[model samples]
Target: MRRLDPRPCVVAVAVLAAIAALTGCAPDAQPGPGPAASETVASPTDAATPSSPTPTPSPTEPALDPDGSAEDNLPLFTEVVEKVWKTDDRVKGRAYIDALVRAGFDKASMEVTKDRSSVGIPADSIQFSVRWTDACLVGQVGPSTKKPAAVVLPHLPTGGCLVGETRPIDW
Candidate 1:
């Protein structure tokens, strides 16, 4: 009686199991609701049954725009801009800002400038100035030696902002 080589068989079974898992056909696979099933709702009770409070909107959903005013949107814009300026130097993950600018927020613009006593990544101390307009932005950034560093963001028709003036701008 010859002993069978178990290694190749074991490897083949492992590969098959991995493939099944990746294809989502494992024994543990469970069915999820279809679109029609998801749309189904339970019947509402009469007025005698108190209604449950409405749930808060999810982050993925846009907030209700009361009166649909541009100024109302400004707070959301300012909050995002300030957060990006204070935390990010490279300005990563600012897709929403780009969208806002591209959306022709000619009435929405921002300027940011940084000032520090010493030149370094983590400066000795820093200060920043900002100004925003409907069509343009002016601001400065720096260690404030002879001149402070500045950045200007201009509105774009294609829906994005531009940065300009590495040297301190007149504002």
Candidate 2:
């Protein structure tokens, strides 16, 4: 009869013991009950059932167009400014403020800059704005302002069209 080596048996036992220790499994460990059968696990199909629905805009809030373009609303803003534009060769910030106010924009939420540079020299451009929600409808008009444009932009937190200074609308 052949005798098995005790050293091989000892090494095998040591290797199994090391593996058991690393895996945190013991001979006396008990298995616990898992998830209930009634519980439905979420899958890719469940994504259709959103946890929360998209909020509906209030009556007073302007809704984004179904086409998903803010440009659809651009006409509403432009009309307000263009209706007040003068046919004469010159453009003024005051006219923009008056026109926007007449068109239902809040006067207190409007900003305009004098037709002059920061150094008090005559500027070729003048800017005006109407604060709308988180944005500003800005209008630029002057010889150098390049063909009179109106653009919508995020308003500064301090609340104005430009950084550091605006002319008071005395009228």
User: Largest TM-score belongs to which candidate?
Assistant: 2
Clashes of each: 9, 0
Error of 1 at 135 (Å): 12
Question: Cα RMSD (Å) per model?
Answer: 18.5, 15.5
TM-scores, in order shown?
Answer: 0.25, 0.51
**Tens-digit per-residue lDDT, 32-121, candidate 2:** 775699987778868777788889777653333334332444565577556655555346677778766766667887788887787877
**Which stretches of model 1 miss by more than 4 angstroms?**
1-46, 50-73, 81-109, 115-118, 124-171
Candidate 2 deviant stretches above 4 angstroms: 1-73, 118-121
lDDT of each: 0.41, 0.70
Model 1 deviation from the true structure expressed as Cα RMSD, one decimal place: 18.5
Clashing pairs in 1: 102-159, 102-160, 106-134, 107-134, 113-140, 114-140, 114-141, 114-142, 141-149
TM-score of 1: 0.25
lDDT of 1 by residue, 42-148 (tens): 54665545578768777752332434444444454444445445644423223323433443443233322233223534432232222233333332222332332
